[model samples]
Target: MADSTGKTDKDVAPQIQATDVQVEKRASDDESAEKGVFEHINLNKNISARIKNPLADLSPAQVLRDVEEFANEHGLVDVLPALKKGALVARDPDHYESVPDMTPEDLTTIDDEVTHKWRQPRRLYFTIILCSIGAAVQGWDQTGSNGANLSFPDALGIPEKDNPNAARNQWLVGVVNAGPYIASACLGCWLSDPVNNYFGRRGAIFGSAVFCFIAPIGSAVCQTWPQLFITRLLLGLGMGLKGSTIPIFCAENTPAAIRGGLVMSWQLWTAFGIFLGFCANLAVKDTGDISWRLQLGSAFIPAVPLLIGVYFCPESPRWYIKKQRIKEAFESLRALRNTELQAARDLYYIYSQIKVEREIAGDGNYVTRFIELFTIPRVRRATLASGTVMLAQQMCGINIVAFYSSTIFEKANATVTEALFASWGFGLVNFLFAFPAIFTIDTYGRRALLIFTFPQMAWTLLAAGFCFYIPTESRAHLACVALFVFLFAAFYSPGEGPVPFTYSAEVFPLSHREVGMSWAVATCLGWAAVLSITFPRMLAVMTPTGAFGFYAALNVTALVMIFLWVPETKQRTLEELDYIFAVPTRIHMRYQAFKVFPWWCQKYILRRNVTLEPLYKFDGVQTRGDNRAVKE
Candidate 1:
């Protein structure tokens, strides 16, 4: 039975399936070696992903020694016992009895963490709530301008309609509305990093609150378009700074399991602010020429609470750790977590992750770190992913309705009063729909919600546009348009509304987080400026049907980009994402197209029972048995 020179047939190797081969090559050092022969070959390949816990295999003695060294180096020798036990527990959260210096009380609280995960400390809730209130300032500003759009033109002697200069006035109106967005995109977002470095998160937030408070009052008093534009731009400075900082502040303070749900309060409170603006608009509709002024000035109301409340909250422990103040970091963590054990565990774990992060990102100046978001392999992937979601938020066209629903209704033959009511309905739907995301975003996950809702939003939006073709004389004309628009708001509130900011906040390594967020926020608000400026013309040229169809197509386009590029980060710690993003873009896209697409077709389309292959191998285990993706 010999085949080769002096070798028996028993020595011959058997053929392996491509799936088996890919699984086998998971440990290979070369990225190209992991590819199946028929798979797309990538010229610009990244290194292999190495996924493991840095402290998992350390013995109790080794854990003690590591803690001792960390404590000694950081001048924390006084709390060595707690540090040792915490280090051990962090290394094995599920297996804590074996950890030394353990108490019965500690065991009970740690056990309760699994059974009662939502029972977080009051200080933790308060911090997230107060910080998230900053988003109200942003939302109120947008809608105050929206409500003002109706009357500001006439007040400034530039009528938006029924005049010889109507076309020019529309563009001018668009420009005036676009001012805040432009200022935020260009200046306010870019200032986030330096501001955070100099003033810390609380200081930056307080400073932004001052601007949010003052700018709205200036907006209320302006007699000319130029003066109002100046005030709006000043509002942008605060909006950009607050918007960029608040989400990160929320993300850092929250537990990974509940992070997305908690952090999405940024969008939730924003919806609330929009609702309040509508109420204000209604309140002043009969006040002659002063209605728009009252609407614009009322935005300062949210800023009032934000300014007074920020200093009362606890600082982010990760921010403290980043500054190398381990003691203060410990104290901050204690306030945020359920127990001292939890605090110590976080302190040690975060410290470990940050050390690895520093090595990955390297020591660099702000400009250098900003460049690394594109240059470094891991960071570049995060940048591209976050940037896509941010850009997609604008492309989804919710802002079209948010900024101009009143005008859109008026154009559809409703009186000005009816239009205000319709805008308020859209705001109500937006705020109410967001509540479901708090329950579903963690369980159903970020990518699932996005994939599920994008198509729904597209069709609903398209339906609303087609309703514009309905006879203007019919009572059902405006009603149909309003119904579809409200439906679109419902679909949008849970998916694209919450995903963009939440996704962008968590993607980057801590080393580049502030700068990366600035980039992501700038991309969002920058495109928002373009949309705001162009939409007046889009309405004039394309009409409502054409604009709706246009953004509907973009919904599909955004879905494709999300499916191909953005990885799900639900329930994942910020540090754990380094491994997830390490898998190159080509590999992720190929798996989605070739593996997942086929499995989806079999399971959902053809009604056949099938198992989809898992993309991620976390903690050296290949997850199986109908577990939804933590996919690349």
Candidate 2:
């Protein structure tokens, strides 16, 4: 057809070449289209990289280096992809804009918000009311014994604080408070199952509430000091047992992200209870016969609402899942989350993770579960770190400050009312600073705060000790003590106080967390009990300077402990941590060797701190209900 106007075949060949170029371009386009949606190379790999690298490097140095080279060589091409292509793609402006961006379709609202909602949900509201009441009881117990030395003589029919028989009253007052704390360590663990199974969290809490209610009333009616001690012991048991359950219930019910903060409300309320008792003391300051019994008895008032309200609250979804009541578990999950579909998704997600943890933990008896918690290297490390931090927390001279504030102030030459007022400042600072943790903990993170603040606390303690040792009754000495004391309390409230409990709750496996926490609490109480008993004796022997010096050294040790141990738990989910730590692969590096050490020590003990990678990797794991993969 072109021949009618054809100039030459060569010109026709040029036209044909153009047509061929078009066909080739179209073929390339079709090939790319068939390959589909830009071929995402699994961002999952990027997230899992930290987990994988550690695993690949296990063994002898030669083997590790060889594996590293192989991985690096093989990874070069994909890892070095062109940045231009990544920059070219633009996200759609409108696609996700309308989505409400609800808390995962699987996750529920946190406890604090749920407790504070405009039309408060029944479970959260009731739980808060119950916990608050329990906290108030705890407050009463802690504060009831505060003025015991002053009034015990009258209450117990002793003639004076120095009565040879006064040891009985002193012992009753101090030891009685400790009894529940020690008993709680065992009872909480032993009773958790029955509480969860025979009765729900609600029922367990209700029983504890009943004890709180009765113990206080009994405390008021006791004619003999022994009777008073027995009642206080019962109250302690209730508080300890019930207090252990709060972390469990709060942690299990809330989302992983904010669970730590929510559970901390228990302590916050505990402080508030102390504050209330202070108020009560102020109210009754002038009344001579304002019996210690009446002060103790007032603890029961809050329990009335809790005893009545807790029965209406929901059971733990974790507990339900443990019992294999999947339907009821899902129902509980939904009620907590405030939706069915999302609740089911979260339930399934948690249920699967729980299944994984159980399998990884292996088949074992109850005692074995206890052993396994500490047997795994990673979990054991976490447990040791948590327990040590707690140890440091108690010995950091805090409880001494708290238990003997009046005495300490008096020794510094302050009057009784002035000492009490200064102690009030300590309480006020504690309460105020604590609220910031609720807001910033999830943001600034647990590890950063602990590490940064502990050193500050150590230095403050050192300086305070120096101030005390200066041999002065000057106002400057008193002022220095006051500043450091308040600073120390502020540091403890946000950093150590809530963090140990939060970290311990987060790190331990769910199956063992209840018992582990019970024991951990026991350790905390055990150490505090020891220190409290000995502190008075130490004060008598060493005087303030020696005692403060001893505690200041303890702070230094705590700082070192925190440095050597303590991994970051910020923004990590409980399930991910479990899988990460289970990996058998970990780097065992002895940074330096001390030549004179025993061969046995060299064989079994680390010469210096060792950094081991997690035993396993769940870096790429994705929950069924959430798109986000495991955080490394």
Candidate 3:
């Protein structure tokens, strides 16, 4: 160093500053790398402000060309003429006369689709009703354990009555109660993708219904607690598979406008089944030693109708389309809808959307689809949103009441008979309140209902927990406990209960739907299993006060998760929601925290006249897939 000069090589270096002109470059590149999940597919750089209507940009000529290309691609030449008119109507329903040779009948059918959206085909109702029956099977069967929890342990030699090993017996009772959920969480839910993939939705439902039928009979005949547990596990297998598929089956068959209302039939009927289970409990309670057996056995009755009726219902047309059974898909859609014109439009539109969805997937097997649920940006958001809602269901603690309401009532000093009656009240309140959701879910939207109801649930549940502290001698104690529990159910049934399944069913793209649903269902039942298995011991240790309080706090946590992550899915079609989920989670959170929340406080709290800026806009930059139509 001394060879160059007295000042060493360090002193000879060029003067440099920490700041640089290139400072802006790398940061942007890093940010882009993170947010580039939907870059090629998205029309707008601000994916938070997503565009709806995938068909919004196509001109009349382009629409015609797209129809021609689609027909040629699918070899649908025989119905090409009908397909053309259908596309024109879908592309612009108001200008149906623009469709060449458009008939008066077409006008009436299209007008009816808007004016009388509920006037669906007979087969569609049969399909929805059948799917609802499957949901009822779970609700009714779960409650069978609720009543049987009183007597089964005694008959099976695992009584939780006062004894040195009563805690152990309590744990055993919890285990037996949890067996169905355990199997469902670990085995049955995981099986959904493969079963649905190989056998279709109906095959999955029918196979599950068989188990739903047999497992109850097996539970009734069990000589030991272990045998009863095994039988319940078998029931869980059926429940997990059916639970994952039924909502999807209902959502796929129903139209967009009333999809929320109709799909929520799953929740409505499940509540009804719970009421029926309580009725069954009371009906058999006077049968002496066989009362628990009868309570457990009666669950199979609901499953019988599901097994018989699923065959009569139309299979989901989306399932048909997924399998490339195009003609069958068209026929199923036609059977589900009132007119061929509507069917053709829906058929072509779903096909177009599926084509785009598949392109995003870029060819994959079941494993790959599951992986893409988190890997693909648009799909990852749906996965997160669905996962949050599903997990929140368990956290909100409805199943605790469903699984142990009678036990909870008894713990609060009500007699066994009084507890059963109280639980029946809870089920009734849950069922009766669910009716408002049918009208409100579509009007108020999924996220809105959840946002409004969660705080009410939190307070009501906490109030129920506090009721545990009231003196046993006071009649008001039991009445107050039951009242608050009923209030909790009243809030839960309409909002959290229906939204999870309905929202999850619609969130994922078709290619990943089965696997996504499998994940969602697994999350729900897995937590339910955990909660059910631990609850008896928890009741002994933490007491009803702490247990209810735990879930009450979770309601608030779940609300924050819903507020930040869940998007508003009101009347948006399945295809349009692809763009909604494409929005980044961070962007959504920022909008909520800074913009939406502020606007709410201003307009609602402060009574200001300020107009709130909307997150989703109708028009924007066009996707590459949509742009191709225009260029062609």
For all predicted structures, in order, the TM-scores are 0.90, 0.71, 0.89
lDDT of 3 by residue, 86-141 (tens): 87777654455567777898877766655676778888888988778888878987
Reference-based TM-score, model 3: 0.89
What TM-score should be assigned to candidate 1? 0.90
Ranking by TM-score: 1, 3, 2
Clashing pairs in 2: 582-615, 582-616, 583-615, 583-616, 584-615
On residues 261-379, what C-alpha lDDT tens digit does candidate 1 reach at each position?
Answer: 99999999988888888888888888988999998998999888889999888887888888888888888888989987788877898887676465465668999988988988778
Instruction: Give the deviation of candidate 2 from the true structure as CA RMSD.
Output: 16.3
C-alpha lDDT (0 to 100) for residue 547 of candidate 3: 90
Best by TM-score: 1
Clashing pairs in 1: none
lDDT of 2: 0.56
Clashes of each: 0, 5, 0
Worst 10 residues of 1 by lDDT: 35-44
Ten contiguous residues minimizing lDDT sum, candidate 3: 19-28
